[model samples]
Target: MYFTPALLAAVATVIGLATATPVPEPQGIAAGSIELCTGQYLQGRCTTITTPTGTCVEFPRGFHNDVSSVSGLEGWNCNLYHDDHCTSASYYVQGEQDTLPTDNFNSVICTPPP
Candidate 1:
């Protein structure tokens, strides 16, 4: 088969993209962050979020009413709220919480220990 210049360039581009090393995800826990999981006993789908000291952030998308366990608090005081925007019933969490009182918390605000 005869290869045209454009075809060769396109093949090269495709090859580069196919063989290029992908950017790896973070390996472990970073400072000022926590992990939440969907299963009790710290098993199953889990995601990490930056706590940003004393800021309130809602559980994004899938995590809403889905987190059954938590870990990596690292001395941060986390107040888990039952309503969005950190209102209504809330539960306090410090240190690694293998399981929450309930998995229905919709928002959380974590403050680093002084």
Candidate 2:
């Protein structure tokens, strides 16, 4: 069978639509990532943490008790702790936390949303 240009274009459109994936809400931020900032309202020095497989991460030395803002938790749930290894005091956070409940957290464990 001979295929015309219009027919090919139509087929491509259909294929593209069929294979397209729905974009989750709050685009840009990935499913398992969080941003930590030293100032409130997401200002000042900032760093991003990615835990695609749900892992515990410790804040670098001097960063402990210095994170006043947190963001990029669109599809993730993270537990902030006041001690290393995700121990001691903990605060649960999800979504953009422009001003963290507490800025003394020293460790975090981030997991993708269920």
Candidate 3:
């Protein structure tokens, strides 16, 4: 195929746009009960709980009152639950700091309630 400069530019533009677009962030954890185990000053803490839908929740940095505590830690140990039932759980540290616990740490894959 004979490629023209304009055609190449158009292709490049399309590729750039496709890659640059960011993925939409998941919606924050739904309404559910959280069991958190946090230490004073946000140190030496571990959290484990079950979401209302059996999503298997975990507490990285042990559930921080704010985002700063888990800002640095990533891939800590934690468990998840949904609807008061144990589903899939794993250990993961904090990925980013956010007011919401779910937003602060990267949640491991877990089996949601059937």
Best by TM-score: 1
- Residue lDDT tens for model 1, 32-102: 77788999877889898887666777887888899898875677888889988887978988878888878
Regions more than 4 Å wrong, model 2:
1-31
lDDT of 1: 0.82
Error of 3 at 21 (Å): 2.0
lDDT of 2 by residue, 1-114 (tens): 999999999999999989969786775434477788899998998888775545678887667899998875677788888988776878988888888877888888887767
| Ranking of all candidate structures by their lDDT, best first | 1, 2, 3
RMSD of 3: 13.1
Candidate 2 achieves a global lDDT of: 0.80
Q: How close is candidate 2 to the true structure, as a TM-score?
A: 0.67
Q: How much is 62 displaced in model 2, in angstroms?
A: 4.0
Model 3: lDDT of residue 47: 49
Pull out the clashing pairs in model 2.
Answer: none
The TM-score obtained by model 3 is: 0.24
- Candidate 3 per-residue C-alpha lDDT over 58-91 given as tens digits, one digit per residue, 9 for 90 to 100: 4454343322223322333333222222343433
Task: Evaluate all candidate structures by whole-model CA lDDT and list the values in order.
Answer: 0.82, 0.80, 0.40
